[model samples]
Target chain A: MAGTDPIHQFVISDIVELFTIGGDGTEGSGLTFSFTNSGLFMVVSVVLTTTFLLFASRNRKLVPDRWQLAGEMSYTFIANMLRSSAGSEGMRFFPFVFSMFAFVLVGNMLGMFPYFFTYTSHIIVTFGLAMTVILVVTIYGFARHGLKFFKLFAPSGVPAYVLPIVIPIEIVSFLSRPISLSVRLFGNVLAGHITLKVFTGFVVSLGALGALGWLGALLPMIMAVAITALEVLVSAVQAYVFAVLTSMYLNDAVHPSH
Target chain B: MVTQAFAQEAETPTEQNLDAAIDATRGEPVEGAVGHDPTADTHATTEAHGGEHDSGVFPPFDPATFPSQLLWLAITFGALYLLMSKLALPRIGGILENRKHIIDADLAAADASRQKTDAAIAAYETALAEAKSKAQGIADQNRETIQADLAAKRSAVEADLGAKLSAAEARIASTKAEAMTHVDEIATETAQTVVTQLVGDVSTDSVRAAVAKAKE
Candidate 1:
């Protein structure tokens, strides 16, 4: 067992291990299918977001209450982001963008709690989301523009001699979009959580030492507080960045002019 | 300090057994043994111990846990997408749309009422101006009529006074003439009495002729 390790906070624990359907697995006999803390937190975020939306707009008054105003603001915030990035045509994918934004935002925020898991910090989850966005954009591009979608890789003013170099580079860059997108989010979140944990570990180690050590621990404690505040801002910003990039990619699929 | 702790965990019998189990599961020789853990499922055992937990560097990178994580992510993402697209989002959209419509209707109604109030004020001003002009016209007309009537009355009064003055003058002239004749007769009578008393009475014809000559 790993004891008192700050990195242990990220470990996904199996809450319920299953063999066949809901059947209990014997000890180390068969491979265990399990529900994890990561999954639990994801579901929690979904529920929270859904309930917030429902309760906020239940009254739907012309003069909005606080809850209703909050709901409206988030809606308009995403709507405007999509509209500005992808134009009026981008409003069709409003729900998708909003969902991604809320999911990431809530997940990051909830993970800031003392013992909660941050699924967005995981490469698999973030990559899955990124791939989904890319897949949707590719499919939509092909569906809307047919063969003309391939023109997105080729610039309009490029010389025929430069086409060989430019097209490959563009294709490579285009393919790297998902990787960058996923990594940026995951790296930011993971780094923030790790830094927070490290600082906290410092506080614990110092406090455990002695009277002088407790006094020294105050510095890292202060740093942890500041970092927590920064992480909150980062969480919101990362969610916004994800949503905006998704919109931009969707815009490329829709227009694909340059 | 952290390195020493990890090294201690590595040296433990339970840690060795756990590492062997992980190695057996992955079918790899446990040759490189510093700061490396093959399986994420080792956390399940560590968590079961209740007093300690596994501290992998990057647990999410573990291949054994990818299936379940991806599966759960897919299910959750699918559920979220459907909820947002079909239900939650549309409801919010409806609320926003309805609010916009209501606000627009209210603003339009306010504008129309304001316009009506402006028109009413304009009409009131026009009526007041017309009434003031009409009153002034009536007063001017009445002044002109009164001035003309006064002029006619004054002229008629002057004419009647002139006629009466002339008549009085003529009567005075006739009275003076009669008085002169009487005075002449009286003078002749007085002279005749004086002459008679003195020597002899003068003749009436002679007195009358003398009086007439003197008057002339």
Candidate 2:
């Protein structure tokens, strides 16, 4: 039942329990050099992303084939997204935005595999990415505008008497951006995967009951299939959302105005 | 053990027997055997958590794997960023630029060739027109020269004919004057002969004066 449990699918189990420098070679010892399933999938995601981009553009034709078109489509998709949100100047952070989009997209897609772990479903990964974007935006904002960046907290149209209330509210909201950004992806992917596992578990458990159970199990199996399909769409949309949101944040950094 | 349980369940027909078997298997000494093998312990724990789903609830919150996940994420993302900025994007940009250059060059070459063709046509038209006009001018000059030459020839022929006629007329007039003189001498001789025969010789001076008055 534990193995069939939907929640267990997200577990980060050790693939190879590695050793530290010295001492009794165990898990929680000197240095944890353990490789987990989560890490394996992360590596897989990265390799897939690299392979796609590298080989897709190897021939680099004026006219593109299917694979090449897919590669270019992704590039332009992010490029256009950045332009729309942050303008041409925001293209300066193209490398960062593109990398994040590819990583998250690949991670989400790979998780659709039955046994593969979805790293983006993990809050740490999403948080790390979101924090990086926010950090870069903050740094760029300060570097570009210096003290004027703080003016973002107190918007231009605010009345002089309402500075204290409005400024604090704005500051809190600004700080909450990374939280909302990370949680949105993690929560969606996490819930979607969990729901799929639960439905799949129902198929197994219900079938175990008997002839009646077997007939009954068809419903959840179909539901599972449907959820899987929905999850696929969600995966793609989340990646888009992540990239678009990053572009918007970067836009704020570049402009830093009301 | 789970597979064995399932196989046994499949063999058994009744639901009660399957439930009993499941219950009996659940209370087995699997946890005690976990001390011998860590993998067994994990499996046992996993089986134990089947009814209660609390053991591996949320992995991202687990502090044990965070450092490793975070570490690798940083390394991978950083590498990706470097690869993107240095290699991938620039390669695409280069391909696009090259395509653009080729297109522009082709367009310019086409335009140049079109202009050259236009110029060639214009030149041919002008040459053809010039030749046509030149031929017309030569024809007009030739016709004029032929007419002038014919006129000069006609005038020379008329003057030659006039000279020959005048000479012929003068010759006739001289011949007529000689004959008339001869005629007068003959007439006087005959008249004298006839008078002499008729009545002793007629006078010669009287015959000559009569002949002269008759000529006037």
Candidate 3:
């Protein structure tokens, strides 16, 4: 902890790396057709989410226990947001929306643990997620609304005289959803972690004065704690916003006239 | 026989006191009462709970097999989506549809009732107006009949009075004429008698006096 290089120390290699197999002589990496770190993390997130929901939903008492209540509240929060934005008609999508929320929330929280990578901070992962949602929305829009869904690109009540100008702008704006949604999540996580890394680097570089700089160390410590809390909030909000927007997109699929 | 059986069932005095003492101290479990019991049951249950390898607790991560991550995500997402579509969604849909139907029916019934109440109120008002008009018409008819009856009775009385007055006048005239005739006849008879009795009687004067009195 004292003599290490914090900047280089936190650098996670992009290549698939091997992890030990317990009581076996096998090696595994992300693409090795075996268990991988990212795969394990994904599995962990799923298992955690599943167990929590199972335990929480077991009795589903009107007066909920603590963990059950927390789970229920999370579910209701996302569901209500979707419903409010997309209407009761959007309740049909609750399962997908709920799963998305749970997945993103658990993934963000799991990455917050020491020795884990912020998977969402990585572009490949974020891009993949973003593309998946975008693809679903696109296909659904077409399947549900047909050619009328293309009207989503051309908003109604826009003055016919302004069509040439407005349509292009609208198209661009509509296309930006996936990009903006993905970048918003990716940027927030990447920025917070990077900021943490830099401050921690300063704390290490200050040498024995690092302890003397303990008072100065309070700054990074406060930022870390504050940023951690903010990150959790951002995690929940991003998931909610994403789900809500997805529902809105679906609403457009259902009613392209709007 | 009952007394003997009761005595036989009752504990001896020393044993009864001991039983009371044991019940009293049972709150403090005897040290070895449960101490010798094996923990096999607990161990069995713990093993049963962990029958699956899914503890959900954080474990080591390996990066070599990334595809499995995608596979797990795909599988879970697929299963959940399918189950939602197949099972949970249909039930939720039915509940929502039923709720919607009930609400719509209630609203419709309320609307129908409101319309019915409005119609009833209108009819009542109309009936009240008609009754008022009928009552007014009946009163008018009664008034007209009473006025006509009074007029008819007054006219008949006036005509009868007029006729009677005329008849009485005529009778007075006739009576005056007859009186005059009688007077004339009486005068002639008196003159004849006076002339017969004594030529000294003034038959003209007496006749003139009688005529003047009759005129008066």
* RMSD in Å for all candidates: 6.4, 10.8, 23.0
TM-score: model 2 vs. ground truth: 0.66
**lDDT (CA) for every model shown?**
0.82, 0.81, 0.61
Tens-digit lDDT track of model 2 for A181-233: 99999999999998998889889999999999999999999999999999999
Native-to-model Cα distance after best TM-score fit, residue A234 in candidate 2, in Å: 0.3
Candidate 3 per-residue lDDT, tens place, A180-201, comes to 8778876776676666666666
Best-performing candidate as measured by TM-score: 1
List, residue by residue over A1-258, the lDDT tens digit for candidate 1: 243466677777776643333324433333345678888888898889988998997986778899988999999999999999899998898998999999899999998998889999889899999999999999999999999999999989989999999999989989999999999999999999999988988888899999999999999999999999999999999999999999999998888875
C-alpha TM-scores of all predictions? 0.74, 0.66, 0.53
Worst lDDT window (10 residues) for model 3 chain A?
Answer: A6-15
Clashing pairs in 1: B195-B200
Quote the lDDT for A146 in model 2: 99
- lDDT of candidate 2 over B1-216, digit per residue (tens): 444444444465465643443443554433322233233333445454442212333656766566667777887788878888888877766776787899999999999999999999999999999999999999999999999999999989989989988998889989999898999989888877887888886689888787788778
Chain A TM-score compared with the true chain A, each model in order:
0.93, 0.93, 0.82
What TM-score quantifies how close candidate 1 is to the native fold?
A: 0.74
Q: Quote the positional error of residue B5 for candidate 3 in Å.
A: 99
Give Cα distance to truth, residue A75, candidate 1, Å: 2.0
Rank ordering of all candidates by TM-score, starting from the highest? 1, 2, 3
Candidate 2: pairs in clash: A2-B50
